[model samples]
Target: MKLRPGGFSADRVLRKFLPRSLLGRSLLIVLVPLVLLQGVALLLFYGNHLNELSRRLAGGVAGEAGFMIDEIDRAPDMRSLIIQETDRYFQFTTVFLPNQVLRHLPPPDAPGPVDDDLARALGQEMHRPFNVAWNTAPDFIRINVQMVDGVLSIDVPRKRLYIGTFYLFLIWLIGTAGLLFGISALFLRTQVRGITRLATAAEAFGMGRDPGPIKPEGAIEVRRAATAFNRMQERLRRFLAQRTIMLAGVSHDLRTPLTRLRLSLAMLPEVEPGEMAEMTGDIAEMEQLIATYLSFARGEGSEQAVPTDVAMLLEDVAAAARRAGATIEIGAPEGLTATLRPEAMRRVLTNLIDNARRHAAHVWLSAAIHGRTLRVSIEDDGPGIPTSQRETVFRPFEAASPGGTGLGLAIARDIVGAHGGDIFLFDRPGGGLRVVIELPA
Candidate 1:
C-alpha cells in the first residue's frame, strides 16, 4: 500500500471511516439521499411557505393596530370606546398608562422568523415608536406604541402568526426517513447474506472441504453468482473423477509391460545371478516409478476434509516410518487437532520422511500450532539443497537427491496446496535440510 504524509495510507484512512460490510454500505447508499432530501424539503417549506405566511399574518396584525391608533388620534374623546371595540373584535387585551413617555428600545431577541417579520410589519404600518415583547406570555405577544396622550399597550394572540404546520411536516419527514432507513437496512442484509454464504462456500471448497451446493437467493446478480459457484464445484469434481479414471487406465497399461519384463527376467536360463538381480531391480524400479507418477498426477481427489488429531496423526506417520526401518523422532503436544484430509496428509508426511531417510540416517518430525496456523517440519542431517536450487527442487523430475523421481516433493506440495497450505525447504540449524509445511489451523 502507498502511504500519505505521517505514514498513513489514504486507503487505510478511508477504510477506517467506511463501513467494512456490504450491508452497511448499501444502507448508506439509501440513507444519504433520504437525509439530503429531507433537509432540502425542510429548507424549501420553512423558508418559502411558512415564512411568507407568517409575514402576511404579521402585516394584518400591524394594520389593525395602526387603525386603532388612527381612530384614537382622530377622536381622543372616544379612545376608550375604540379600545373596547378593538379588544372585543380581535380577541386582544388593551391597556393605557397615562402620561407615560416611550423610549427607544432595541429589538428583542427573536425565537424564530415571526418576531423579526412582525417588527418589520409594525414599523411599516404603525409609523411610530413601538416595542414588541415576545416572551412575556406563552400564547400572546405584547406590542406597545407611543400615542400623543400616553402609551397604548396591546397583546395579540400568537396563534394568528403561526399555523403550526411546520411541526407536523417535520414529524412526518423524520418518521418517513426512519421508516425508509429501517426498510433499506433489512433489505440490504438479505442481499449481503447471500454473498457471505457464497464466499464461505468458496473458502471451504478451496480448503479441500465439501460445503455442498448453496441455494441461489437474493438479487439477480447474487443468485447468478451462487449458481455459478455450484456449477464450478460440480465441474471440478467431474474433472478430478475423469482424471483419476484415465490415470488408472494408463497405470495399468504401463504396468503390464513391466510385469512381462519381470517374468521374462525370472524365466531366463543360464543367466548370471548378479545380472539377473540387476535386471530384476531395474524392472522393479520402473514399476515403482510408474506408481509414483500415477500418485503424483492423481493428487488428492474427492477427499473431504475433517478434523483430525494432528498430534496423533504425526505419531502414526512417525511410527510407520520406524516400522519401515527408518529412525524417526517427534515433538508434538497432546490434542493438537486441525482440519485436513488425513490420508492425503499422511502421504505428504510419508514422502518427506522417506526422502529425508534416503540421504540421512536420522529424521525428525514435529508438529506445532502458531496462532491460526499449523506447522509441521521434517528435518534431517542430509546435505541440504543449495540456495539457488531450493525452489527448483520442487518442480517435477527435478530431484533434490540421487535416484529420486523428483515427484515426491512435487506431490507433497500439490497435496499441501490443496489443503490451502504451503511447503518450504530451508537449511537446518545443524547444517542439514529442513522441509516445513504450514497450514491453516
Candidate 2:
C-alpha cells in the first residue's frame, strides 16, 4: 500500500506503542489484530445476544409484577394473597405501599446495556408509569409502579435478569484469546531469531571477522534471505582470495626482472656517471612503487583482532616519526583500549604519519573515544590538499605530491574499510591537512 504524506512521522508516532526488535514487532503483528477482533466480538455479543436475553428475563419479571398489580386492583382485600402467590411462583418480594405515595423515583445514572434493555422491556409491559432501579441493592432490581392511592414496589433478584451463558461465553473468549496470544508470541520469537542471526553474521563479515557457516532456519522467506546472504559472503571471500593471489604473482614476476636490471647497472664501471645515476634513480622509484602496490594488495594478512591500547599505538607512531627526523606531538588518554587488528592499525597510522612528515615539519597524532567509536587523527602544519582533490587522493595511483606512489591514502582507506571504519581528510583550521580515522570500539 502507498503511504500518505507524513508517513515517516506517523511511523515514528506508532513506534511509541510498537516495539523496536523483530521478535516484539512480529508478536505485535499477530496480537494487535487478534485483540481488536476479540474486542469487536465482545461488543457484538453484548450488544446483540446478551442484550436480547436480558430483555427477555426483564420482561418475564415485569409480567409477573403486572399480574400481581392487576389482582391487587381487582380486589384490594386480596393483596396479601397476590403477594404470597408471587413470592411462591416468581421468588420476588412484593411490598404494597397503601398510605405512602412515592413522589419521584430517579433514573439510573450509569446505565449499562442490560439496564437499558431491562428498562425498555419494563416500560412496554407496564401501562402505568414506573421507575426501575437496577442494582439499587447488590442482589436485587427494584421496580416502583405508580398507583392512585400508593406505589407497588417489586424487588426481583438480580440473578433472574442475568444470562449465565453470556458471562460463560465471555470467560471462554478471554481465556482462549490469552492462550492463543501466548502461543503466537512463542512462535514469533522463534521465527524472528533466524533474522537476528542473519544480521549478526552479516555485520561480522562486514567488519572482516569470521562468522562461521550460517545454518538457515525459520519460515521459508527468512530461510531464503539467509541463503542469499551466505552465497554473497562466500563469493566475496573467493574474489578477495583470487585478487590477492594474482597481485602477489604479478609483483613477484616484476621484481625478478627489476632485480636483474639493478645488478647489471651496478656492475657497469663508470659508463657515464650522470646517465648511470639517472637510470638508477628511475629504477629505485620503480621498486618503491612496486613495494607500495604489494603492500596495498596483501592487506594485513590473516591477522586476528585483539584488544589493543589506541593511545599506546599513537605514541608508538609518534616515536617512529620522531626517529625519522619529523617533529611530532601525541595527545591521548591513558589506557584507552579497543578491539582492533593491531598490525593493520599500525600500518594505517604509519602511512598517515609518514605522509604528514613528508609535507609538514610538525605533525600531531591524537586519539579519543566517542560513544561506541574511537577516533584517531593525524594533523600536519603543511600545505593542505584542496577540497576538490581530497576524494581523488584516496584513489590508487592518484598522488597529490611529487615522488609519492599515491597508494598511501588508498591503502589506509582499504584497511580502515575492512575493519568497518572510515578515514576522512579535512582542512585543518590553521592551513594544514587533518586525516581523521574512526573505528567501532
Instruction: Choose the strongest candidate by TM-score.
Output: 2
Candidate 1 backbone collisions, by pair: none
Evaluate residue 34 in candidate 2 and report its C-alpha lDDT on the 0 to 100 scale: 89
How many backbone clashes can be found in candidate 2?
0
Q: Which ten residues in a row are the worst by lDDT in model 2? A: 103-112
Poorly placed runs, candidate 1 (over 4 Å)? 1-16, 54-162, 186-194, 219-225, 256-280, 325-333, 357-372, 377-383, 425-436
Model 2 gets an lDDT of 0.85
Tell me the spans in candidate 2 whose CA falls farther than 4 Å from its real position.
1-25, 96-112, 127-129, 146-152, 224-286
Cα displacement (Å) at residue 155, model 1: 7.1
| Model 1 lDDT tens row, 61-103 | 9989988989998999999999999999888899998889776
**What CA root-mean-square deviation does each model show from the true structure?**
5.1, 3.9
Model 2 Cα lDDT, one tens digit per residue, 212-299: 6698999999999999998997887788788788888999899899999999998998679899899989998898888888989888
Angstrom error at residue 165, model 1: 2.0
